[model samples]
Target: MKRITVAVLLLMSFTTRYGGQQTPSRPTVLEHVTVINAGSAPMSDMTILITGSRIVAVDRADATTIPTGAQIIDGRGKFVIPGLMDMHHHLLNGSFPPRPGGIQANLGRLLAVGVTTVFDPSIGRQDFARLKAAAAPDSSAYARFFGTGPMFTVKGDTFADADSPMPETPAQAEAAVNDLKALGVDAIKIQRDDLSWAIKGSGTLMPLEVLAAVVKQAHTQGLKVYAHAPLLKLAKEALSVGVDGLMHGIVDEPVDAEFLGLMKKNGAVYVPTLALFEDVADVAAFARRQAVNWDRAKLQPPAIYAPFADAAGARQIESFLNNSAFTKERLKVARANVKRVFDAGVPVVLGTDTGFFGVFLGVATQIELELLVEAGLTPAEALRAATINAARMIGKERDLGTIEAGKFADLVILDADPLADIRNVVRIYKVIKGGVQYEPVDPATPR
Candidate 1:
């Protein structure tokens, strides 16, 4: 992960603090909606009552009473589910020195697509305060932002950006964890892979001792450690070191019994960014057939794709295309591994490495659900991965996930039932964040 410049932070702070939308003052009620609570079976003819920023009640519509003067939204034919959470969303643009309006644009696009919360795994430590301010519940314009500070990596690793801390020794690694903890980071992200799949030659991996120290210190600080381990060997090493989650599934090969045992023993969560790998492989395949001309206007949402229409985007695409065979194989292995791991009782949460080339913020999340279904997960199980499972990954299930009373009233009202067909998740009718109903916008249209 790279550091967001001070300039970007200033811009974000200004926009988030002073230029945000207001939430509704009146209590809102959704009556007769089919509710997919994510944790339990879908409930039909449910009534969800929202006051201020919390859900006050959720009961059978026939058994509930409508408060006087409440804003009654007739959800008679709609399906309501917990707002989507993109666990691996990058708040910063994929490119360096992120494009102007990139942060605000990504946030809006995510909210417009029913993503009420986003977790950035590789944010700069200096940007957390501003991110928190931007994600305040009062400002219902964007998805709530949470992130791990800079990702820990070793020195001289090509994948480590200029801003990532290269803690070479155990002490340095411990210090890095302490620094992030002081900054109030949500979690710790460490890189363990050698990047052999993307780069040739002997790629450097983080020292085992240093990786161990980072994980131990992070756990001691009451933070979970998520490792950027894509290969099986690195995944095993990360799990052995007591990391709480694998940011990506094992991509090099099918998962074995030993790996499953380690995952079960550690009670670690598997965040299979299936959409990330599929996007790369799909882009490469497209490039093979024609010239890689990413026309922004041709995209469904031009603003979202505009940032990637430049030379930076081209380079990212070309680099992956150069290793198309490996990339394709990675996607196949990752998909298979997700099913195997999920079947083995290892928790699987939804995460999309959005902001990468071709992985649009909110759009990729929908794609991830579809991909999860393709990987053998039932539509209902796939929804749980993005809803309850994602909240569990961040230890916020008590407050954020499910449709129970007393939780934040973050919901997505869909025109169709996602449990019947996962693609129906994109049939977003309205998005309610913190009891505020935000009209979903067309990304192609200017703000």
Candidate 2:
């Protein structure tokens, strides 16, 4: 076994070692391992070869030939799975006071914990470009970044804030999509609720007519549209307009037959951020959880959200979490709806809405997987939501989200089988992103 020393990892060159020596440039090999490709059964005694940033080969250990000068990783008892993704998150760090670049500092922690990919539904073009540049392959620490540039909302939407692009008419909606495309966004996020008032009282939710036009125009530019509709009514409206995905779960009530049928017919992906709802549903419990884990998270290197991890930030988060936004019964329905959606053949993907409230980055993706399993998804199926299904949602299936030949070599080496216990996802032994290897996080001292 080899150790990865943090001191040797250069921020500029992106280099690594096998046994405390300079690694060769030929290729990297993981020999005699068990692989879970998410959509398929586990394959044992396999050899995975990485050259440059792509996986060049995946064959049985006995049939594969060892290339000269290649760095070989002994994986006799390891299990490998594709790097996980947090499909719903916020990318901007400006909201947090006392420090800026919050999201930028978390890039290294994201890669350290096997979150090699992330999808932020709300971000500005400038921030997205900065995140993308920070996560470039040549950088020593980063996660593959994909996001919607500036979420769309109504004129007075509370979540819209100052950074959101508010579109009031069909023409404005069309222009908004065009502007986002011009900014090189990977997708468009449209909010169907104002959130300033009660869900039922919020006036002038993004008009359905305008939303339809936005969806149509975004499709013309080949960008997927993700809907942020927290309530069932709003979600139904978003679905009626044919958005590609729903970024939040239907928490107010169980999804009805009409919504399920619409989802099935339209092939709309669902990202049930159950963990987030759990935090919001039981504020006392959430506060307790925060009190216990806040220190550990703050100890992490780079301190991505150092401002938010401080006493003032903790007080703010506690005040926010203590507010009873949704009922306990609502969360029950939300969980049931997630199970129902999964059983009904709707694509239920894993997402934790990280970078908001108590949903920490790096670790939230793992919690989301466990929550999915609890919501009646098989471990493999839950894994798919974070891997292949997520990639497919963003039209990136051909390049990422799996351990296959010709795919980016982004993977996680685990000490235990996640199939047996979803919690094993946290027991990471190593992380490899874009064929670049990294030391895994120790749960006792995560950094």
Candidate 3:
């Protein structure tokens, strides 16, 4: 068999030696991998025994002897953790500017990074349902599609990337929510004041009534609502209006004590997409200091990123990054906000806002975990946010997110103990979901 590097694999048309015409199913047993079962009841180690998509048992002492006729993996010093999930992702084909092979390249890169499950808080109506479902279910590689179709933006004033199919009237808004519910979307992404887009350009915000209506109608069908209200006031408003969660910390001012209190009282989960601020600041500084800009030249194709490199998008990026208020110093305040909410024990789910900056999904998920620890989480706590904690937020804690008897067999093989060092969580060797195998590419270390 020809030795393929198995890294930076974006083109899907290529045939692989291991992956071929047939779809791979889940392996029966995984040996040698140190399993860090992220659980609350009783955390222990054992060999995971699987049948179909569910784990049959986890015998602590003897994993090899527990199951026969099972495909056993040679863990060979790898670590095993629950497959990582991302809460805030942009899963759209045309969300960015017109760039050839842009979305395709981004998706491929995401899989390489090890994100097994992703929740695109915002996606276009035309693309979300069709492409999300149209994508094949592989046992491994990339975050599986779990998304809300499009932002419920007001007519005309929507971002160029968004699919603004929102209705203006209360009746129209209610029906729009019903249509999304009928399509069985995971959630609705409520944008800020996009109704005034034509008049105000970018400062446009969604009306309070529209958001309230969407929230009410979507929840009636057992769906959740996520809103993008950057400042404390918007966040508080969303909470007061009974929004399920807040997306990022783009608030115009510092979050006050009263609002923090309300966030705790409401049992609302916060999915702070913090990595963007960090990446932007870090990359900007690097651009100034670096002798050569590699990611722009080699890592990304000019044809792909050209459209997104517009005056408007560039202005937005610069404004967000240039705001000293949202700097590393500000991270202290954000941490205080996180600590305040966390101390109150409000659910702060893990999300990377991947698909930004041409990053692949899988790798971006791990990066999010790394940042979570940097803020305040211990290794185990960080793992929890990505796995068990995320499941709870999605209202799927009863079934998904862990490796146990009767739980789904979605697991990642790591090279070290994430519990001991959360940063080591990226040492992934494979991703197994629902009894299917996504064997990690481990080409022999070059001499």
**How accurate locally, in lDDT, is each candidate?**
0.74, 0.73, 0.58
Q: Which runs in model 3 stand beyond 4 Å of their true positions?
A: 1-27, 39-45, 63-66, 92-109, 135-142, 155-162, 193-202, 250-254, 280-282, 285-329, 358-361, 441-447
The true-versus-predicted C-alpha distance at residue 10 of model 2, in Å, is 18
Identify the leading candidate in terms of lDDT: 1
Estimate the TM-score for candidate 1.
0.87
lDDT of residue 72 for candidate 2: 75
Q: How many residue pairs clash in each candidate?
A: 0, 0, 25
Where does candidate 2 clash, by residue pair? none
Give the lDDT ranking, best first: 1, 2, 3
Per-residue alpha-carbon lDDT of candidate 3 for residues 1-447, written as tens digits (9 for 90 to 100): 221111111111112322222243334666545667565533344566666556666655342353334466666567677767678877432224323334433443343334556777776676566545543444322345677877776655435354554666667778988888777688887876321211223465567776788788878878888877656766777778777787775423456677767777766687766665454444333222221222312324333333334556545445534543334445555555654566657777887665555332344456667667777877777778788878877777766677777776767777776777776665556656555555443211100
lDDT tens digits, residues 304-362, model 2? 44434466765665454443454455777888898999889999888887766555555
- Number of the candidate with higher TM-score, 1 or 3: 1
Judging by TM-score against the true structure, name the best candidate: 1
Candidate 3 scores a C-alpha RMSD against the true structure in Å of 7.6
Who is ahead in lDDT, 1 or 2?
Answer: 1
TM-score of each: 0.87, 0.86, 0.78
